[model samples]
Target: MTTQTYTPNEEKRVYAGTTMLMIGSCIGASLLALGNRFSNLGWPLSTVYMTLAVIFSFWGYRQIIDACTYTRYSTIRSLLIVTWNKVIAEIVGYATMFLIFGFLVAYCVISSDYIHSIYNFFSKTPACNQPAAYDEGLCNEYIKCVAASNKVDKIIRAIVGGGAFMLLSFVSSVGILSLISSLSLILVVFSISVILGRCIEALIKGKLAHDSGGWTRREPPIPYKPDVWSVLIDFPSYFSLYTLIPTIPSLYAEMKGSISEKTKIIHRTSIYATVVLITIYMLLAYVTSATFYGSNQENYRQDNILNNFSDNDKLVLSVRILYVLVIFTAFVCCLFPCRAILLDIVKADRTTKRGKVLFFVTGIIIVLLLTILAIFVPSITLVFDIITSLFGFVLYLGLPILVGLKIPVLKARREYMEATRAAMHRKDPDTEMKQTNAMEAKIRDRTNSITAFLSVFGPGATERVRQASESIVRRMSMTSDRLSIGGRADRASSSSGRRLSSYRHSHIPFKGVPSTIPEASDLSKIETPPLNNVSLESEHARQQSRLQTIPETYEHDRNRVQEVTEPDTEEEETTHNISTRVVTEQVAIDHSHTISDEVLLEGFTPPKVSLKRQIILWTITSLFIITNSTSFVMTIIKIFSPKGNTGVCPK
Candidate 1:
């Protein structure tokens, strides 16, 4: 059978594309519920929460940037595998998968529900015809009108949810996420402009600030007295606001540029997106709350703020349409990262037919599951609450910081190895040997330090540290001995059948002399003046005898060289440090084959970092993990508490 050739899946992504992806995913269906929730917090408090959330989000986003810079891993699973062990990585990886799935289901549910709401709002005629009658009787009748279409609404939701995912699958297969993101960005800007325009119009018409005060008589910028309840209610919304942070690594990986350039792109795009999102959310929340700020304002609260506005208003109707487009585009944008992570987990080559089949199979199953969930579980509040509180904490807040701590430790080791290796390339064998001895001492000290620091993590950590240290030490010792200048000189002498240097061969006594010989290591302690004081005839006789023994010594070296040239057993290589041994053997081969010095120094293993640096990194890592874990537990407890806020705005 003939084999089919497939094209590579490489696609170019630009700065605008990256920016649009961030904004598109950030402004998902969750924003529909934001106005109501922010209204509950009022102007000052919500502004504070959003500000703090942005700061933390940016901090976490920076960690991912740094991680991608060093590791160049495209997916979260890949980064996790390097920063932690495979077992922990897989555990966290699967959890992140579920998190993304939850988000996918949430987007579907919110989008479908909002579409139904929009339809219900416009399709039915109001019971009260007059403007004054709207508040007196029509408002209540509107709820009844909406409920009357429940059966039709469910059918509409199912069709929309399923059709949207089907469209996403088709679009993804065709590789149009870039096109989708661009469109989503346009929708995002238009939607924001429309909301702000309406807000500005309300302000111009003097419909916002009441005679009671700017925000109401008692609380100027807040509706209710700021309490513990408000904080808990707003916390999850804060996490939801910056939900795009977790997907940044995948996006960073896809961008076509050097690591530095990608970092710059991410930084610039993130700043712009943050400014736009924050300005819009804060301004919209302030204006929305200002319009209806009072004890009676709670009466107007909606899961979707559009419900509070007049259905007949052209601006509001257009906003609904804009949101519908935004939701679908955003849905497609979110799917790309999910696909990337899933493919990474399965270790599938996307260019192959089997891999493509697996991807479609997985995608269909996920979409079908999400569609069923959207049809049945219609509450967006419940979905966002659980997701932002739990997965949000782990993925966005916890993992990034955890990875950041290990980065510096690895970086220090790398820099140290490079500097030491460069220092060892000196022309003077004595100087190079001296530096090599110093490096050994330093390595031992660092190993001890690393072991002590790791011991704090408990015995499992300590044992791993010990093994790594022993393996690294053994490999370094072999490498240093084999690759050092003195070692190179010795190898050259043996291979060329030349007499050894005096400093190395002084331990061998002259064949005719009966005097004691100095050890090579103790050559410095021997008195050279005694040799000078001997007679010229005796010296000539000693030199002639030493030359006579050269053939035997060369023959012995030939045999030794033959033995050293033999290939090592695979099992023996495996027993040592694999990476170190491979690199060392490569260098040995390079030397034997007369490869350049630069090529020989290329694959040296990084030495352990100083103990102080390890302490600092581990300390910071523990701090971040502890803080995130504690906050996560507390949030979870509050979420499940009997009296906890369901993140629903008060009616």
Candidate 2:
């Protein structure tokens, strides 16, 4: 029997590819809905809030990238696993799941309108009787000739949107999606440019200002007092505006080149995405506010910016087409992170036929649920608020900040370990000990400060504060003994690998054991050939000096050296591939390993669930339950909870 040799899947995504992936995925469709939501804060104040979010969001994104590099964690859950525990990781997973579900619900409702408009734009159905009489805006010129659109329009649109969703589901292949996403971004930018130009033209022609009093340019920007509670709720508004921050882990994973190169990619991604998003957000907000101002204008309020425009007007309809184009592509791109993470959790790899089935089914199920939501409870801003303010806080703001605080201690410990290991492996230990002490002392002082800061839970400790503190304390303290750094190239290559950069040792098995591999799909477990060639001299050289910058793993067992030559087989893979595989796999590990299933299955400890984690898990789970409960209750109450403005129903 001949065992078939298959080529491994390795995608070489460039920097531009990174930018396109982020822009397409992060730019949310709900952005078009943000105008009316923030009308209270006025355009200037709202712009300030959004622009600041963009800047802070950029800082947050970079910090997340740094946290990953410093810790060498490829996936978000891996970082969570290493830094905290499985419980914390699981909590984050739950958050992602809930957020995605909520987004689907919200997207279904929002996308329905775009779908309806798109259908109305092209077809002359009974709903749109006067196909040729469209120059009239929704304000009446064109609407009089058209039949009144109702829930039927939304249902029909949902069906069509579902078709588009299904089509993108299958074609959302890794490489192909990159090109698709880039194309989508182009469409969005072009479309936004047209609308932006219209906004500017209206403002210049004094068409937007209905009266001299409506133009408040010479007057101070609208007076606004933002409360803490209101601000948190309003984050969903911004969340809908900027959805890219949630996908940072996947972005980090796809980055090409060295660690620095990847960081540069993230840096550029943040700048480019932020600048573009903030610019458009400001302009859109300005148009919405300037177009509809004061308490009287609130009476004519619509759910989104499109509702403010005449659906029958040729110019507005053209812009609506652009929005539909963006929403179609953006919605597909948004599913990637959610789908990828869910697949990993379920132990389904997308590399196989069965895995592809699992992938497609997952997408279909998600869209199906969203379609139901659109038909039943058509929510928009409230859903966005809940999604962003709650889970968004955890994934976007909390983890990054926690990681930022934790990085210094981790860096210190790493430095200390490297210094100590170098001294031990040096030709003249006596001479190196003198070199190590000074650096070690500095690191020790830093670690002491950090550990102290971590230990104290002084006051005003809410669930988030408690969760973050406990998580940081647990991960740092649990790894305190093993904080001995000098990762892959630094540790003694023990037979069991318990001490080999802690968990990273799982990448290598018994050093010189010869073996035949089935496949590289499970990178964590399987070892490569020529495992015994590492000499103590080479190991010591690496330990005492700076390691090579190549992507391959540089293993060094300073305490022991075993050299055994191997006879070549009929078909042998390249040394570079085998070696590179070792290091690369280390960078991209998950919960379990293929070869070490017995030990890997027992990898993470059971729920010694810390107070912070418990709180987080509880809050997230509760938040999910409570929000759905509240929404349902509110839906029932909307039959009596003051008719027109509750935004739940009968609008």
lDDT to native, each model: 0.57, 0.54
lDDT for model 1: 0.57
Give one digit per residue, the lDDT tens place, for model 1 in 1-651. Answer: 433221233212455566667876677666766666665665568777778789877777777777777667787777777777787676666667777777788767656655765774677544211122236355555456546555665787678767767767655453464565456656656766766676566657654321121222213435544445445645645756776666778888776656666787788888877877787677766666655534444334455555555555666667777666666766666676567668887888778997788777767777888888777764565566666656665766667666765677555544655565576554698886796667545543433332222222212333443554465456556778566646554654463232213223323222222123334576455322211111322433443344334334444553464333332653233222222323343344335434443554476554555578568656755654554455456656665677732212211
- Between which residue pairs do clashes occur in model 1? none
Instruction: Please report, as a residue range, the 10-residue window in candidate 1 with the lowest summed lDDT.
Output: 209-218
Which parts of model 1 are misplaced by more than 4 Å?
Answer: 1-25, 72-74, 121-124, 127-143, 163-174, 204-221, 224-230, 243-273, 292-295, 336-358, 376-378, 420-651
Task: Enumerate clash totals for all models, in the order shown.
Answer: 0, 3
Residues 8-87, candidate 2: write the lDDT tens digits: 23222454566667777766656666665456555556666677567657666776777766666667788777666788
TM-score of 2: 0.56
